[model samples]
Target: MQPFHPIPVSVLTGFLGSGKTTLLNRILKDPELRDTAVIINEFGDVGIDHLLVEQSSDGVIELSDGCLCCTVRGELVDTLADLIDRLQTGRIKSLSRVVIETTGLADPAPVLHAIMAHPVLMQNFRLDGVITAVDAVNGESTLDHHEEAVKQVAVADRIVLTKTDLVDPASREFALFTARLMQLNPGAPQISSHDEDAIAAKLFDCGLYDPSTKTADVARWLRDEAYHHRHDHVHDVNRHDARIQAFTLTHDAPIDPQALEMFIDLLRSSQGEQLLRMKGIVAVADRPEQPLVIHGVQSVFHPQVRLPAWPDDDRRTRLVLITRDLDESYVSRLFHAFTGVPQVDTPDRQALEGNPLAIPGYKS
Candidate 1:
C-alpha cells in the first residue's frame, strides 16, 4: 500500500546503562516534538519527564513538555495499532510523529523490520531513522562481548555518545571510544548527548525526508562520502576485537541491477548471521541520474528506494558493510566478481594462493 500522509517513526535504542533513558528524557522536553507521541517500555521510568502533566486514568499521559507518553502494554504492534486508532478517531490531537524507545538490551533489527514489514503499519507509518545511544564508559566492552550491542550500533543512522560528562573531556578514553564507533559504523554521524540544543535538529530530519522542501533528502540520508577512503588501513585499536569489522567498497562505473541482487543473495546465504548490516547507494548503468538506495539487517532487507535524481556530483556505487566474524577479503571478492571489477590486494594481506580475490578456502 502506498503511504498517504504517512507518519515518520524513529527508533531509539542503546545498550544497558548507555543513558538511552537520559537522552530520551532530554528529547521529550524539546518543543519540536510537541506534535509527537512516544512509546516506551515502562511508564514509571519515563513518567518523571512529565512532572507537570497529571497522569490520566488511561495509559496515555499528556505531558506539559508537549508530547504524549504511553507505555507498551503488550506487543509493539498492539501499541502502534492503538495509536493509529486514536489518531483516526478524535481521541488524539495533532499527532504527526512517533518515537519508540527500545530496551537497552534490545537488538534494533527486529524493531525496524516490524515497522517496515507490516502491511497496515506501512500504509500509515514509515521508518524515519534509527538513533542509538552509546555510553562513553562501557561502550567498548559492551560491543566486544555482546552481539546485540554491536547490532544496535551497526544499524543506526545516527549515534549519540552519552555519559560524556562522567569522563574527563581531555581524556583519551572518550576519543578512543569515538574511534571505535567510527570503525564499526562510519556512515552514522555521532553527536554528543550533552549538546542538548543540537539534539533535536541533528536527530530529526535524519530519514529521507527534507522537512523544508518535503522531498527525499537522499544526499543527507546516505552521506556516502563519509565512508569514502575510510577503513583503507586496518588499525590496531579497532582490530582488537576481530569479531566485528566494517569496510567500504567503491566503483566508478555503474552496476548491473541483476548482478547487485546476486551479490547480496550470495552474501546473505553464506554469512547472513554474521552480516550485521549492509547499506549502499548504487548508481545503475542504465540510469546514471537515478540511484538505488539499499539497506538490510541480517537476512531481512527493506525494499529498495529509487530516488528521482542524483543527490550530488559523486556518482560512484559506494557500499558499507558491517559483519561479525566475517572476512573482509571474502566480501570484497563477492562484490568485485558481481560488479566485474578487479580486486586489489595489499602487501600485508595474506594473499589468496589460488584465487585473486581471496584465499582458496573462501570459495564456497
Candidate 2:
C-alpha cells in the first residue's frame, strides 16, 4: 500500500551573498549527503548558479531560465512534479529528499507559499525544514538593514553562522552577540557551519522544537535543563506580532485511539495554520508496551506510527507546540473539549464553531 505520507522538502534560504551556495557546496561535497536532490533557482538568465552546483546527471535541476516567483512558478511546480514522476518511474533509483536553493535575493515566503498552496504539489512534498545561512562577519549590519534577512532568521528551523573562522579572536564576542541576536525564535537550534560534523548533525534530525527522543539532551534544546519561558525583544516582534511562543501539554494516562483521532481531526480542521510544528509520543489505551508517535505538519499528518517499544520507561504524553500567532489557551481548550476533560473554561464546540482560530487552513 502506498503511504499518504510525503517526503520532506527542506528550503535552503539566506539573503543575497550570505553563503547559501557555499554551504550547499559543502553539503554536496559531503559523501553522506549523496541521497539528495538539489533544485537551484536562478532569477536572471545565463545559469551561472547551475555551473557552480556540480552534481550527477538527473539529480540536479538547473532552474536558471526564469524567476521562480512569476515566470517559472508553474515550472517550479512542474519541476517538482517531474522529480516525483522520475522517482516513481525508476528514472531515478531512489530519492531520500529534495532541497530548493532559492536565489539569494529571493523571499522564501512566496516560494514556500507556492509549495504549500499548490494542490497537485502539496500532496507530493512536505516542508521539511528551513535552513538559513547567515554570514557571521556581515550578518549584524545585514540583518539590521535587510527585512528579508530578519524574516529569514524569524522563520528558520535552524540558523547556520557561516564564515566565522576568519574573524579575530575578539570577533568571537561579536559572533556570540550575533548568535544572541538570533534567539528571536529560541526553539530553533543554532549551529556553526564551519564544523561539517556538527552541521550534519543539526541539519537532519535534531529535536529542534521538541525532540521526540528522550535521548535528546533536553538541556540543549531548552538552552537550560531548568528552562522557564523568558521573554526577549529578539522574540517580541513589535508590540503586536507574536512569533516566538512555546507551550507544553501533559497527559497523566493513555489516550484511546478513537479519542485521539477525533482530537487530531479537530486540530487539523480547526487550528492547522497556527500549528507551526507539533510532535508527541502518546500512550495508547491498550498498548502500554509501545507508544504512538504523533507528528504532523500544519493539517497534513503521517499516520501516527507506533514504535515497537518505548525508547525508555518515561512514558507520559508530552507535546510541544511552536507557533507564530497561537498559544496554549486555544489549543488546550479545543483538545480538552474533544477528550472529555474539562481543562478549558470555554463553552462547547457548538458555541465556538464560528471562531476564526477554530478553522485554520493547512495551506499557506
Candidate 3:
C-alpha cells in the first residue's frame, strides 16, 4: 500500500573478479530474495538473458523470481530516485529490500555517503549491512597489494569466502588465508559462498534487522563478542599491516546525550579520514531502557536510531572501532575529556599548555 515499508538497502562489494557476480546470480534465483531490487554498477556484468525478465517501462526489469534489476548508468542518486518514484506511483509493487552491487574497483565509503547524506533517499531507505566477497584462492595476494581490498573486508558485516573448493581444505595456505581474514576483520562472520543456506542465513539479514521476526537484532548486529574474543587470543605478527587496527571501547556508566554528541562530533571533525568504520550500542543517561544505535563510515554518520527496549540484560555501552591510522588511547582520551571523566594522569600545566583542547581541566 505505502510501498510496503522502509526498505533495507544492502551493499555488496568485492575486489575485481572476486565472484560477486556469481553470488549475485545465485541470490537472484532464490525465491526468498524475490522482492528485492538490485542495482548493479554495470549492466554487462549481469546476465539478464538467462533470467525471465519482464519488460518494464524503462531501465527497470522484473525477473521471473519477482525481483527487480537496474543499472547505474548515471549517478546512483538519480537511479535510486527513479526507483522510489516508480514504487510510489504503483508501477512497481511489493518492494521489501534493495541491494547495491558496487564495481570491483570502487570504494564503498562514497556509496554509503551518498545514500546516508541524500535527503530523498534517506527518507525511503535504511542501510542494512555491507557484504563483501573474497576469493579464497587469491584473497591473500589481493589484501597484500590492494588497499581497497583491505577496506572492503574491514567494513563488511559478513564476508563470503568464494572459490574455497579450488584449494585443499587441509592445506597450510588455506589455513593461513582464513587466519589472515580473521586478523583483518575479526568482528565480521566469515562463511563460504558455496553453501546456499549459509549464504542466505548469514549475509542477507545481518544488519540491525531480524529477518525471522522482522524486528531489530541489536545485540547480534553489534557483535561485540567477536572483538572481545580476538583480544584474548594470540596476536598475529602481521596484525599492524597498513596501519589498520580494530579495537573496542566499553563503559559501564551511562553517558549524557549532549556529551556523546560532542565526542562523536570532535572525532569526526578531527580524525574522520582515519576512521574506516564504527558501530556501537549506547545506554543514554536519560533513557537507559531505550539504547541508542550509532554507526558511521569514514566522515559520514547515519542518523542514530533508538530501540524500543534493550535486546539483552547487558546495558553497558560498547563501541567497536575499525580505523586506518587512529589509536585506541587517543579515542579513549577524547571520549573521557568530553564526558568529564578523570583521566589516569592529570595533565601538568606545561603539557596542558602545549595542547589545551586535549585536557578537560584546561582553562584559558
- How much lDDT does each candidate structure score? 0.76, 0.60, 0.80
Point out the higher-scoring one by lDDT: 2 or 3.
3
TM-score between model 1 and native:
0.84
Residue 313 in model 3: lDDT? 86
Report how far residue 165 has shifted in candidate 3, in Å.
0.5
Model 2, position 261: C-alpha lDDT score:
88
**Ordering by lDDT:** 3, 1, 2
Error of 2 at 336 (Å): 3.7
Candidates in order, TM-scores: namely: 0.84, 0.66, 0.91
Clashes of each: 0, 1, 0
Q: Which stretches of candidate 3 lie over 4 Å from their true place?
A: 2-4, 196-198, 209-215, 231-240, 348-356, 359-364
* RMSD to the hidden true structure, all candidates: 4.5, 7.0, 3.5
lDDT of 2: 0.60
Candidate 2, residues 1-364, lDDT tens digits: the string is: 2433465577889887778867876665555555566676543422345434333343354322211211234567877887777678766656666778877666566666656667777677656567888887787667666766766765566788888786663766674546444444565666778874736557754332212232333223323211135344342244222444555566778878787888787676666766655656778787966777665656665555567676655677766565556656767765655545645335445444444234222222
Candidate 2: residue pairs that collide: 270-358
Residue 91, candidate 3: alpha-carbon lDDT: 83
Q: Say which candidate scores most in lDDT.
A: 3
